[model samples]
Target: MESENVDMNIIPPQIAGGAMDAVEKRFFETEAEAKTFFENTSKRLLSVNEWGKYAGMSSFQLMDAHGIRADRTAEPGDFIRIDIPGPGTHAGMGYDWVRVKEIKELSNHEEQISYIIVQPCSHPMDKDGAIAHFFKDDATSTFIIRKFGLVVSAEEHGRNEIPNTDHGKFLDKSRNFVVGMAAKVGLSYPQWKNLVKGLLQN
Candidate 1:
């Protein structure tokens, strides 16, 4: 979980993309092999349990060298990753990351595995950026978890300060709610183009 040194200073000014672009760029052994691996594995990364509290238990890069609990058990220097699941009916749900502080697993194989834990967030967009949430329904609720598979170390917000309740007030019907936040940070891109386009129309 080598993540604390992450420089939050720079923001990539591009729209976050979905569809697991193994096609556009080949990072694996071969294009077809990449596609197959991506198709099989990528969905598992984005998809979460019905409770949304934890990710599905299969695609861990590492085994048990580390554990990610909901309570901010991770330290600032630890690494974190998230699989951007989807955009709402209208937009994409971006991925998020957090840090890990302590871990019992020391083996190289175990350390590479990503930790997961689900807490509660009005928006599930990852720390990287926010995605468009274009649901017509304003009554629905979704959770944007910070550290998907981590431990809940303390009373949570108080002792660890893992962002327990930032967008929470706008939980139900959080469509415009989370999108608005992205606009302020300069992190929004193609995903955040809807309202901006409308503004330009006039």
Candidate 2:
């Protein structure tokens, strides 16, 4: 009688959080493939688990060497959702939308993959520049946000950092949110118009 050994480290699909029905069904063999898909279709990259369910494959089959299956993909003219930190004194926050100027992925010093999602912001003379988020591959959960408005604002404000809880203050000193999301699922901004364009071409 031979005993079957199982690896406990492997996360099963059943525990990978149920299938993501809100996202469209798409599959890519590699990161480059995924990036190309976004460029052509203007679609956000789905998580490895989401892609697995959609493609009827396993997570192991979908993830890259870095365990990154996909990321939030956007092109210029896209309105990405960001919660701008307001003045700490008044606790007033700004739930705003900014246009995406550029989106690209790069590797960090530790060889971890990160996406540099950049959006130009005008915050008066000294603060005028792009607000970029260096979202690491492993920080998926902390990086993207689905819901917007008061609920998210409250959660962010209550985080560890006390005193100046405003995100803008941090950005002024070279800091920003782990990542900002436009929507929970799929691409953000100019949604309907882009959908129509894709459909007409197909």
Candidate 3:
């Protein structure tokens, strides 16, 4: 591929209201090596079901995260089904859902960047399901993978328009409260940190 100057800022800022960001990168001995690794990393990043494997390797057992695609491809409207612990283990209260809003890519020869942006959404199966949404609709989780020269980086940026709003039943609302507090206290950082590390891993 022929390399070109890509303006990464065009991806738009995912941060809003209260937010958190986690980034991890790995350097290769040569651009050839980075390109090879970038290809493998991209596959894992898009295979949402594999998220639990990375999260399990982290210090905290954040949740058994899983991605359920609405169609054959991982395009917009896909749903990410997360199996949280505690109350989340229950039938109606065990999951949170987010919808894939965008999947973008920009590449030339020496540089490549891909983005997967998701926002909190109502349950796909049941609009009024008892399940809770961890973040508000304005909240978004943007996952990025960039390969530039001999270096490759993975990033997770979360933006929450309102970190304190309640969006579901009492249990769902309580879950949201706990998640909001967790983000505020920095407990959610490790989960993202490990996730990005997993993406960059050889």
Candidate with top TM-score is 3
User: Estimated TM-score per prediction?
Assistant: 0.20, 0.21, 0.80
Per-residue lDDT of candidate 3, residues 25-136 (tens digit): 8989986888888888877777777676786532211122243343233656667777655455122336666677887787875579888888766666565553345567
Q: Which ten residues in a row are the worst by lDDT in model 3? A: 57-66
**Which portions of model 3 show Cα errors greater than 4 Å?**
1-6, 10-16, 57-73, 89-93, 108-110, 128-131
Point out where model 1 deviates above 4 Å.
Answer: 1-76, 88-93, 105-202
**lDDT leader:** 3
lDDT of 1 by residue, 56-111 (tens): 32111111114233323333233334333333322223323333232221113211
Alpha carbon lDDT at 19, candidate 3: 78
Score candidate 1 by lDDT: 0.25
Clashing pairs in 2: 146-184
List model 2 lDDT by residue over 18-67, tens digit each.
Answer: 11111122444565654444343322232222222222211211222232
Poorest stretch of ten by lDDT in candidate 1: 151-160
Quote the lDDT for 199 in model 3: 79
